[model samples]
Target chain A: MSGTFNDVIQIIYLAAASCFILGLHLMNNPATARRGNQVSIAGMIAAILATGAIVIHDGLITTTGWIVLLAGIGVGSGLGLYTARTVKMTAMPQLVSVFNAVGGGAAALVGIRDYSTLGSHVAAATSVTTLLDVIIGSVTFSGSVIAAGKLQGIITTAPVTFPGARIVNMLLAAVTLGFGGYMIASPSLAALGVVIAAALVFGVSMVMPIGGADMPVVISLLNAFTGTAVAMAGFVIHNTGLIIAGALVGASGGILTKLMADAMNRSIGNIMIGGFGSGDTAAAIAGPAGAGVQSIAADDAAIQLAYAAKVIIVPGYGLAAAQAQHEVAALADLLEARGVDVSYAIHPVAGRMPGHMNVLLAEANVPYPLLKEMDEVNPEFARTDVALVIGANDVTNPAARRPGTAISGMPILDVDQAKSIIVIKRSMGHGYAGIDNELYANPKTSMFFADAKKGLAELTASVKTLVG
Target chain B: MTLLTDFIIFVLSLWVGFEVISKVPATLHTPLMSAANSIHGIVLAGAILIAASANSLIGYILAFLAAAFAAMNVVGGYVVTGRMLKMFKRRTVPASAQAPAVNAGQNGGKSA
Candidate 1:
C-alpha cells in the first residue's frame, strides 16, 4: 500500500472515532439522541469499510479466511437485526447485557488469537496488553451473560450465594491476576489459557451473588469492563480507533455506574460484594404487618385522582413487569382531560436500568416532558394532591429518609408529602430490598392492592365513570 | 504505535468522553448507555484485521468467532440503541373528548 493510502485509512479511523464522540455529545438531550445514534451508525459503517479495505490491501487472507469472514458477518448481522427488531421494550436491558457478552467475548478472542499465534515471540508490551485484554474481556463476557440470564428469568433474580462466597471470589481474583502476571513475565501459552479460564469463572461468580435490584449498576459496570477490554485489545493490536472508542465507552459507563449506585445510596463496592436483596419482590408478606394500613377501593383511589389538582405517578419494576406503561399513560391522559395536572416521577434506578422507566412510558406515547427525574419531581410531590404510586416500592419508601435501614440515605420520591397517597401493589410483599415499604403505612397513604396493569386500568376507568 | 502514544490517545478520549457525558440528564441515561455500548463495538475492526492474517485451524476458528461476535455486538448494539432512542419522543395528547373512550369498561381494580 502507498504511504498516503495507509495514512488515509488511519484518517478514516480517526474520523470514525470523532463521530462516536460527537454522537455521544449529541445524546445529552432527548431531542437529538436519535440523530446521535444515526451519526454513530455512519461512523461504524465507515470504520468497517475502511477495515475491509485494509484487509483487501494486505491480501494476506486465504480463500478459507474470506469464506469465514463473510459467513461470520452474514450470521452476526442477521441475528443482531432479528433481536433488535423483535425484542420487547421490557427486555431492553437484557438485550444490552447480551450485547456486552458478545462484545467482550469477541475482544477476548482477538487477544487469545494474537497470543497463541505469536506466543513467546511477542513483545512484552504487547503481551501485557493482551493479558489485560483477555482477563477483562473474558470476565465481562461471562458476567454479562449471567446478568442477562438473571434479567431474562433464566437465572434467579435473587442473590445466589454459598458459604465463603467472598473467599471464593478472592481466590478467583488471585488466580486470574497471578496467572496474568506469569503470562506477562514469561509469555507462556498455558499461562494465558489459565488467565482466560480463571477470568471467565471469575466473571460468573462476580455476577451470580448480585441480586436483581442491583442490575442497573451491575450492567453498567460490566459495560465499562467491556469497553476497557476492547481498549486493551486496541493496545494489543495497535488500533487507534479501538482505543478511542473503547476509552470513551469505558468512561461513560463508569459515570453511569456511579450515578446508578448513588441512586440506590449504595457504594459500588458494597453493591458488588453481593447479598443485597434480589431485584424482584419475592418475600412473603407478614400478615400481621398489614395492621393500621388503609386499603382503598378502586372508586376511592379514582376519586382522589379525579379531584386532585396535581397527580404524580411513581412507577417501578413491577409496572414494567405488569406491562402497564400504557395503562398508566392512559390514566394520566384521562386525568388531564379533567384538568388534572399529571406527570410521572422517575427514579434513576427505578426499573432494571437507569432511565428505563422513561423509555417504557415513552413507548405508551407519554410525552417526554411529563417524565420528571427524581430531583426535579421530588419537590413537586408536596403540592401534589394525590401521589399515585404504581408498583413502585423502594424508591418511594419513607424508610430511605433515615439511616441504619437497608435503603437509608437513598433518595426517595417525596410521595409521602402529597395530600393523599395511594399505592397500587400486589400485596404487602417486600420489594427488592426484602424490607417493608414504610411509605405504605404513612398516614397520608393508602394501599390499593392490585396488579399494576389491572390497577392502573381500573383507576382510569373509575376516573371516567365515577368522577364528576 | 508506541505504548505511550496509545496511552495518550486513550487518556485524551476518556477526558473528551467525561466532558461530554458529565452533564447528561437522567432521562437520557438508558439511551446514553445503549449508545456507549454500541460505540465499543469498534472492536469489530480489530476482529476483522485478525481474520485477515489467520492461517492455522485454531487461528481460523478464533478469527471466525471473533468476527462474528464483534459484528453481532456492532449491529445488535446500534440497532437496539436506535430502537430505544426512537421512543424518547414528545407526543401530543389527543383531544380530551376522546380520552374517556380510551379507558372505558376496564376491569375492576384490587387483588383477587
Candidate 2:
C-alpha cells in the first residue's frame, strides 16, 4: 500500500473508534440512543473500509476469495435482516442468545480453519491459543443455543436437573480441559476435534440446569465467553480488529452478567447448579392466592390516575411482554396534560433483565427525566395519590420483604406504600420466580386483569376522554 | 495490488461492517460502541508485533503509531463506560424506603 493511503486508512480507523466512543456516550440516555447507534455504525463502516484497503494491499486474498466473501456477506445480511424484522419482542432475548451462539461458532470456526490450514507451520504458542479459542468458543456456542431454546419455550425453562448431574458435568469438563491441554502440546487436528466435542457437551450441561429466571444472566455470561474466545481466535490468526472487538465484547458482557446476577441476588455458581427456583419452591412463592390479592378495571384506574395530584407508574416484565410502553407513555402524557403529576418508578429487576424496562421505555421516546429509579421513586409512593403497577409482579410484591415469605429479605419497590395501587395484568399467574405478590391483596390495591397491551390502550383512551 | 482483489476486499469489509452495525439496538449502541473502542487496542497490538518483525523503518513507525492510537482507545472507552454505569447507579432508589420529610400530597392511606 502507498504511504499516503496507509495513513488515510489509519486515520479512518481512528475516526471509527471516535464514533464508537460517541455512540456509547449517546446510548446512556433514551432520547439520544438512536443517534448514538447511527454514529457507531458510521464508525464501523470506516473501520471496515480501512481494513479492506490494507488486506488488499497485502495481496493475500484473491478474486475468488472476494466473490465468496461477498456471497457470505449477502447471505448473512439477509438472514440477519429477516430475523430482526420477523422476531417478536417476546422472543428478543432468545434471538439475542442465538446471535451470541453464532458469533462464538464463527470464532471457533475461524480458529479451526487457521490451525488446519497452517498445520505444523504455525508456532507452538499460536497452536495453544488456537486450541483454547476452539474449546471456549465451541462451549459458548452450544451453551448459548440451549439458553435460547429455553428462553423461546422450545425447551422447558425449568431446570432439567437429574441425579448426579453436577458430578457428570464436572467429569466431562475435566475431560474437555484434558483434551485442550493435549491439543496445545501436539497441535493435532484430532485433538482439536475431541476438545470441541467435549466443550459442546459441557456447554449443554452448563445451561440445561439453569431455570428460566436465570437465563438472562447465563446468556450475558455466555456472550462474554464468546467474546473472549473470539479474541483468542484473533490472537491465533493475528487479526487486530477481531481481537479488539472480541475483547470489548467479552469485558462488557462479563460486567453485564455480574450486574444482572447481583440484581437477582444469586451467585453465578448457584445459578448454574439448577433447581434453585424450581418446582414447589417457586410455586409456593408465586401462587394464584397471591394472584387474586386486589385489582380494578380500566375506568376506575383511569379515574384514580386522572384525579390524582401525584401518581407514580411502575413498569415491569408485563409491560415489555405486552409491548405496552408506547401506550403507557401516552397515558403518562395524558395524565401530565391534565395537571396530574406522573413519574415512572422503575425497579432494578422489574423486567426480564437488568435495565430491560428502561430499554423498552426508552424505545417509546419517553422523557428520560420522568423515569425514576426504585430508590428515588419508592419514597414518593408514600405521598403519591396512586401507584400504577403495570404488568410487574415480583419486584413490587411486598411479600418479598415480609417475614415467612420465600422472598423475604429481598428489597422491593414500596408500591405497597402508595395510597392506592392499580395492578394491570392478564391473569393471576405468578412471576417466573414463582413468588406470590402480596401487593395484589392489599386493601389499597386493585387488579386490572387484561392483556397488558389491550389494558394500557384502554387506559390511554379513557385518560384522554377524562382529560378532554 | 490487483483491482479485483481490492474490490472484493472493499465489498466484504462493507458487508461485515454494515451487518454488525445493523444488529446493534438503540439501547445498546452506546455501550456496544464504547466496548468496540477496545478494537483500537487490537489494531495497536497487531501493528506492534508486525513492526517488531518488519525489516523496514516505515513498518516500525506505522506499527508504533497504530499501537499508540489503539491504547488510547482502550483507556478512553473504559472511562466513558464507567461513567455511564455510574449514572445508572445514581438513579436507583434510596436504600431505605422511608418516606421523605415533606408530604407531597397524600399520606400512606389506602385508596379503595
Candidate 3:
C-alpha cells in the first residue's frame, strides 16, 4: 500500500478522470463526439489499471476470485460490443433502456451481496439502507426492461388500459412499500423476495400506462429512476463515486423528462396516471376535427416548392422509417440551386428522442448550418415562402399552440404561417402522440400522400426536368 | 492460473472494446460515450465499499482514487457532449460535411 506502485496508480486514476471529463465535453457535436469517446475510453483504461493495482495491493481476493472477475469482465465486454454493433438505429432507444436496467440491476446485486455477507450481524441502519436499495433498484431494473420492450415493439406501445388499471397500479405500489417496510424490520429472505416481486410489479405498472407518443418523456423519467436507485445503492455501499455519478444522471434525466413533458403540454403525473395520449383515444379525439384535409400529387408539390422564394423543411419519424434523409437533402439542393433559400426546422422532441432529427439529417450529410432549432426557425416561418413537411405531423400541428387541444400551449414550428405548405405523408394517420395535424387541413397546405423518400425522389426528378 | 486468466480477459476485453468502437455511428458517439461514463460509478462504488468495510489505509487511498477518477469522467464527458450538441446548433456547416462531397464523387457527379 505504501509502495511506488501505489503512487503510480493514484496518478493514473487522476489522469483517467481528467480524460473522462474531456471526452464528455467533446461529445456534444458530431465532429468531435467520436474523439470524445476515445478520450473517455482512455480514461477508463487508466481507471481499470488503477483498480487492478489497488486490488492486488489489498491482497484480499484469492486466485480463483481474480480468475472469475477477469472472466466476467471479458464476457460482459464481449456482450456489450456485440449488442452495440448489431443493433439497428431504430432499436437504439430500447438498447439504451436495457443498458440503464443493467446498471440498476448491478447496483441491486451489490446491495444483496452486502446484506448476505453481513447476515444477522448487520446493523439496523445497514439493514434499512439495503432494503431501500433493493426496493428502488429492483423497480428500476424491471421497469426499464419493460420500457425497452415497449420501445423495441416486443410489447404493445399503446397504453394497456384495462378495468381498474389506475386502481390496480396504486394497490401494487402500496404493497411494494409495505414489502419494503417488512424487509427493513425483519431482513429475512422471504421478506426480500416479497419486496423484489412487488418492486417488479410496480415498475411494470408505472410504465405500462404510458403510450408510445410520450415515449421520449417516459424513457427520460425511467432513466432518472434508474439513476436514483443506483445512488441509493451507492449510499448503502458507501461509495462516493457511485453517489456522484448517480446524482448527476438523476438530476439531468429529471430535467429532461420535464422538458419533454412540457413539449407535449402535459404534466408528468398526467403522463403516468391519465394515460392521455394513447393511440386510439388520441386518434378518436384529434381525427374528427381535421377531416377536411385535401390531397395532391408529387409533381404539383414539386412545382410549388421549386417556385418558392424560401422553404423550411420539417422532418419526423416517418422520414426516419423511410430512410429518406439523403433524398430530402437532394431536393433541398435542387431548391437552393434555383435561388430558393432552404432551411430545415427542427423541433426538440421531433423524433423518437432528443436530437433525433439532427442525427438523421447529419447522416444525409446536410450542412449543420442549415438545420435550425424550433426557437431559431419559428420566427422565420412567418416570412417564409413555403414549408415543405417531410413525414412530419405532430411537431408542426397547430393544435399544440392552439386552445382546446390536448397539446394546447405546447410550442410548435409555426410552419402554418408560411405562404404555402406542402405536406408529404403516407396516410392521414395520426402521429405517435395520437394527434391529428391541423397543418394538413390548412388552406395553404397541399398534402402529398407518399413515402417521404419516394416523394423526395420524385420531387427531385421533376425539378430536374423543369430546369432542363 | 490467475495471471493466465487475466491475460486472456485483457485480450478479450480489448477485442470487445474494438468492436464497440467500430460499431458506434458518428452521430451517436457523443450520447453513448456520455452514458458509458456511468461505469465509473460502479468501479468507484466497489472501491469505496471495500475500503469502508476493511477500514485499511490502502483501501482508503484506493477508494479515494477511484472516486476522484470516476467523478472526473462524469464532468468531462458531459462537457464534451454539450459542446458536440452545440455544434448542431451552429449556423455554419460542420467540418464533417466532407462526407457529402465524397458521396458525390462516388456517384460520378456533383449534386445541384
Best by lDDT: 1
Number of the top candidate by TM-score? 1
Please state the error at residue B83 of candidate 2 in Å.
24
Interface RMSD of each candidate, angstroms, one decimal:
6.3, 14.5, 13.1
Report lDDT (CA) for all predictions: 0.86, 0.63, 0.63
The residue ranges of model 3 lying beyond 4 angstroms of the native Cα positions read A1-22, A26-32, A279-292, A337-339, A432-436, B1-112
CAPRI class of candidate 2: incorrect
Roughly what TM-score does model 3 have, to 2 decimal places? 0.79
**Tens digits of per-residue lDDT for model 2, A415-463:** 9898988888766777766755667778888888787888888998887
Q: Arrange candidates by DockQ, highest first: which order?
A: 1, 3, 2
Model 3 lDDT, residue A225, Cα: 69
Where's the lowest-lDDT run of ten residues in candidate 1 chain B? B103-112
Using TM-score as the measure, name the better of candidate 1 and candidate 2: 1
Order candidates by lDDT, high to low. Answer: 1, 3, 2
Residue pairs clashing in model 1 are: A212-A279, A213-A279
Candidate 3 DockQ score? 0.06
lDDT of 1: 0.86
- Winner on DockQ (2 vs 3): 3
Give model 3's docking category: incorrect
